[model samples]
Target: MINACLLNDDDTLKLVSVAAGSTLPTNTIWLDVNQPDDEERQWLEKLLIEDVPDEDEMDDIESSSRFRVGPDGVHILSLFPQRLANDTRGVNMSFTMRKNLLLSFREDDVSIVRLLRYYIRHGKANIRSALDILLSLQDLKVDQLSDMIEDAYSTLDETADTIIEEGHVEENLEELVRQEELNGQILQALYDSRRALRFIKKTFESSLDDRQNRNIDEMLNDIESILPHTQFLANKINFQLEATMGYTNHKQNKIIKIFSVAAVVFMPPTWIASLYGMNFKFMPELDWRFGYPLSICMMILSAGATYLFFRKKGWL
Candidate 1:
């Protein structure tokens, strides 16, 4: 968890102990830390000779509303990681550059530490290799969100079309449930993307470099533009899920009602048969030769009358 990489000759980062005086090249040394504790936090501050902002300060740096400069050339670039309200898988990466040293802080476990170690050992340049790394990570999150939205878009489109073409969404119930889950994911992704962009706006210093500034701006716009659609699609998915559930319930109730009516229609016939089935003394069917035929006729007539009455009342 406390892996440190020192960028070395040949433009690479090699693994270095976090102990003091690692003798790292000032220009190539980059610190990649995950969920840094108080001790690690102090170490970075000691090395940089500047007050490293705590979590709150780190968060504040993202607002783009405040600007400050330190004695060293330490430029802070922090971007909130894209995450859902309840997501635990994604990590946030923050870059702090000062005195030709780059420091990264992340909550989610990232491979940046390994990458840095390779940079130092191999003397590779992380700045060039990792420029798109941040973008790639952001793109991954955005694409996942878009896929969920697009899936719902397709499913709802299909559900809508299925309702139009097949007259209703099939009774898989499982598919509808899956759609519900995807809706939650999509909604969460939208919020996460927005939160990340807000951080980008606050922490990004366009004056640092022209190309990076443009890249950040372009990524920000891309996130913002799709946000509205993401929200709407989430809502739409939720609505369709509710409506489909209602329709399924209605269909179930109708089936139960039919069974109830069938039972009602057979009630008279069952009653007649039960009443005459007794083997008591002087039973009519046992005594008279034609009694069986008469009883059967009476039962049939009663059943027919009951059915007719039900049909007349439109209860069939």
Candidate 2:
């Protein structure tokens, strides 16, 4: 969007095309323009008596634009986490000239457009006013980080403080599930924190002044302070998840042991029957009248020996 702020005061408001913005009765004019048509750009071009900076030219504005044109100590092009790029909670981009005018062009940044409109409406679109607005935005961003982590810390702390153990089996499992949820939330918050830091870092990289740099550092510090706590919470979640897995494995092993024992207990009987079933004509044992009874006894003895062996080996 394109926003115009005329920062010419009554005493210094002199209209002489384009010169240095050293003095003037600043008249602030702010507008919100999105996808500015050719006609709109022409209008802006006429009003400013200067060419409008296109999005392409303004992509890495700090890199392309001169120090004089860029915001003091603040780079015009700052990278945000990819997540923020999709965020719709946009802020207004402000435009301010030294009591002269501010012409802002943002075809992709919606929040900046909103901010421009809000500040202009509130009589806060002058060059000084615009700087104030931007500072407030930085502050707001910092505040956002603080609030998000603060709430997170409190919730995690509460969970850590209390343990609900006496309930139905499902309840116990549900608690584990809840812990998983908490961890997920914490990870999300961490992602957000990182995103904000990236954005701040991008802003600082282009900054040409100390004030803006300080702002970026402040934001980074905020993220850093919470990192340890967030990391711990994440670790706690992982530990819990691992412990739950161990219990599940133990239960499975016990079940497998029971099945194995049953198989072993019947294996000896199976061997004895298979041996007798080999009814060859030259089999003396089979020809004897007591052979069948002897085979049965032999099978019982084999079964007993196998069982004892298994018991002694602690296979069960």
Candidate 3:
């Protein structure tokens, strides 16, 4: 769907829905194309006087494909965090800026866009230019990432406590790996945003005012702060993983030790039985009635001796 928001003469924002045949309002300042149909895409292309990239093009990771500067203006393809039912991740989004207009295309909704809308509707933002809106979106995206990191910190704390206090990670290897993967995703998203911001800062070096530059600098600082946080979480996860492996090794060793001690305890009995079973017609003990009783006594004594030896050596 195509959703357009126009800034009015009275400094208020008005939202408009642009359908297949609907005309784009002349005062439109921001146009959001969400999972646009072919007709809507064509309309946007015509309105913006530039070709709208397809989903595949938007997903490109190369610097050249991600950002471009032209006589008209700058085009940026960025990845923003999207929360899934079970996980949070980054999704590619396309933004085109020309003069006072900013157009965004995404296959799905993102919190950045939602937050932007909330600010505009509540008159809490003074969005004077397309770049202003972009900066505001970036600010909100950073906040979202920070919140995710805070949650990860809490989880890692709990995981560490479980291992220290309860003496177990209480999760299989797969579960631990999944958490690591999630942390990696959050780290990647932060990196992508940082790259995008730096590119923007460099591209329009002279156009930005002191306030805009400070805002961008503040954003960079925020991302810098978050980067270390993710690194800390990663280290903690690795520690937990190692702790899990150590516990597994301990348990396995205990089982092996039990079997080894059992074998040692049984050795003497097996040896006495084997010695008596030897078929020898000339053996006097074979005919003796007390032979079996004597053999049993020898086996008991040998077994007890072995057990005591192991206990003294602390190998029991």
- For each candidate in the order shown, give its overall lDDT on alpha carbons: 0.57, 0.50, 0.82
lDDT of 3 by residue, 58-93 (tens): 889888888888654788988888887657777788
lDDT per residue as tens, model 2, 1-316: 3334444544221222322222322354323345677876766655553466566654433424422333322223322111142121222232323221334445555443355446555665433434434444445544554554465456545544443332332443455465455445544444444553455455436542576566656766766776676567667656654555565677779899888877787787888889789867788887799999988888788778878888899775
Question: Which parts of model 2 are misplaced by more than 4 Å?
Answer: 1-128, 146-220, 244-252, 255-259, 284-315
Looking at candidate 2, the ten consecutive residues that score lowest on lDDT are 79-88
User: Candidate 1, residues 214-288: lDDT per residue as tens digits?
Assistant: 666776676677778756865776677677777777888989988888788678878878888877887756788
lDDT, model 2: 0.50
Which prediction has the highest TM-score against the true structure?
3
How high is each candidate's TM-score?
0.58, 0.46, 0.92
Worst 10 residues of 3 by lDDT: 164-173
Instruction: Specify the highest-lDDT model's number.
Output: 3
Residue 264, candidate 2: Cα error in Å is 3.5
Query: Under the 3 Å rule for N, CA and C atoms, how many clashes does model 2 have?
Result: 34
